[model samples]
Target: MRYLTGYSEAVRAQMQAIHARQGLGRLLLARYPAPHGMRTDRALHAFVTELKTEHLRRAPPIDKVLYDSKLQVVQHALGLHTAISRKQGARLKASREIRIASVFKDVPHDFLQMIVVHELAHLKERDHDRAFYQLCESMEPRYHQLELDLRLYLTHLEATGERLWSGSGSSGAHAGADPQPAAGGRL
Candidate 1:
């Protein structure tokens, strides 16, 4: 329920009913079924790059993309996008990076894509406004649904402390135990 703060009372009640019956895990597992295979930073970079190329072709180039074990879900930061500028000799160079929480390493591909799409949307729209959401939808048609499902999954995890999906690529770590932050900690 903490993860579903913005949802309506009805929705919260529905989730509560499911949790009371201990069916949140079952619902999430039925919907997601499997975790994705992009476990390493290199593979994550490739995955993000492909998504960027397909959706934000004209956006700034991304210098890095990786799963950060230090990003805690309790902090409400599932993914982060950062742009850093440094004086490179006689000129300034900017590098963009996206960091996904390591908890996502054990989630479904749709959940991963939803977070990635969110970070990728930041490349063009800096604020979570209508334009930003429109951009997200452009990239992933099921963006809103996936986001709601991800929140539900987080709610399930918070309530039961059980992971619905785990496999070879999963870190199998609890989301709240990781407390460090990436540079500039802005979600």
Candidate 2:
């Protein structure tokens, strides 16, 4: 699948077999049955801030954290971390923001956490190098497994156009919602 380009042919074939049997969604649901109820932008901001506080306390502060409908999963931009500069009188201020794709709003908590951990890692290591992955793993012990599962979820979505999780507290209510105002804070 396009989402699994980095995986080996054998792994891809295994995934294909799972898809052939329509077990992708079942496998994911068995692993993660519930969604983490951080639905609103305010909630997302708090969730991200807590993680940042616990892991990267010395890194640059995050000015905003919200679900962005503009991010397309096909492009591999599940989440983004940006530093925006502004001129506050004579001094230039840099504001860091993290935007997660709306599709993640309906996924498992571990999937969302993996994406946030990746973006949070950017606060220190800018590139996707060894140090960046090390930071991600430090923040979440199951980082790699969650990432692979997320990719599998994306592959299943791209193939069937069906969502495995959808209901109250886990629906797509905020999937295309507008970006809320910055939840300004420093940890």
Candidate 3:
């Protein structure tokens, strides 16, 4: 199970309750990619390096990166919609800290890269307006369709309770592992 580290115990308990009641644990586990035998540090670093490269290519420098292992639960997404500005594909440098969802640990490289592209776009455009989507489209073609597909994929995973990717079937699960801290970055 993924733990929401750093959050209040009460909030964490509340999250646990919500996830249990909704059967989110089973849903997420069933759909989440199984744990890979490789070291999370090595794999996550490689992935982030690629993401950072793409981020530097068209977007401004990212200040700090924060990812939640439990963010995949979807139920924990409450209140963030109001407190934090929602950007479909972009945000400005002046904008507040950004939060993103990884959904599954062993996600496809292309799909994960696509999401990084989406968040990087946010660093440029802070809304889902035409211009914002235009920028996203420029960064990633078929932006509209890709967004729809991604949402649909998540929805389908939820509906059918199927795993996204297969991995080593070790009992030690890493589907929701926290991001490892890098020199100037955190997983």
How high is each candidate's TM-score? 0.87, 0.86, 0.48
Candidate 3 residue lDDT tens string, 1-187: 2334434456446545655576543444454344443235345445545665754466544444445454545534300111234565676233233334434355444445455555555666666456665665676675544343333344334444554455332222122212210111111
Candidates by TM-score, descending order: 1, 2, 3
Q: Global lDDT for candidate 3?
A: 0.44
Tens-digit lDDT track for model 1 on 41-87?
99989999999999889999999999987766344577888999999
Q: Ranking under lDDT, best-scoring first?
A: 1, 2, 3
Model 3 error, position 67 (Å): 3.7
Q: What is the lDDT of residue 70 in candidate 2?
A: 68
CA lDDT, every model vs. true structure: 0.77, 0.76, 0.44
Name the regions of candidate 1 deviating beyond 4 angstroms.
73-76, 167-187
**Clash count list over all predictions:** 0, 0, 8
Candidate 2 lDDT, 1-187, residue by residue in tens: 6666666677778888998999998888899998778888899999999999999999989999999876763334778889999999999999999998887788789988988998899999987777877888899988777777777787677667777776432322221111210111111
User: Which window of 10 residues has the lowest lDDT sum in candidate 3?
Assistant: 178-187
Clashing pairs in 2: none
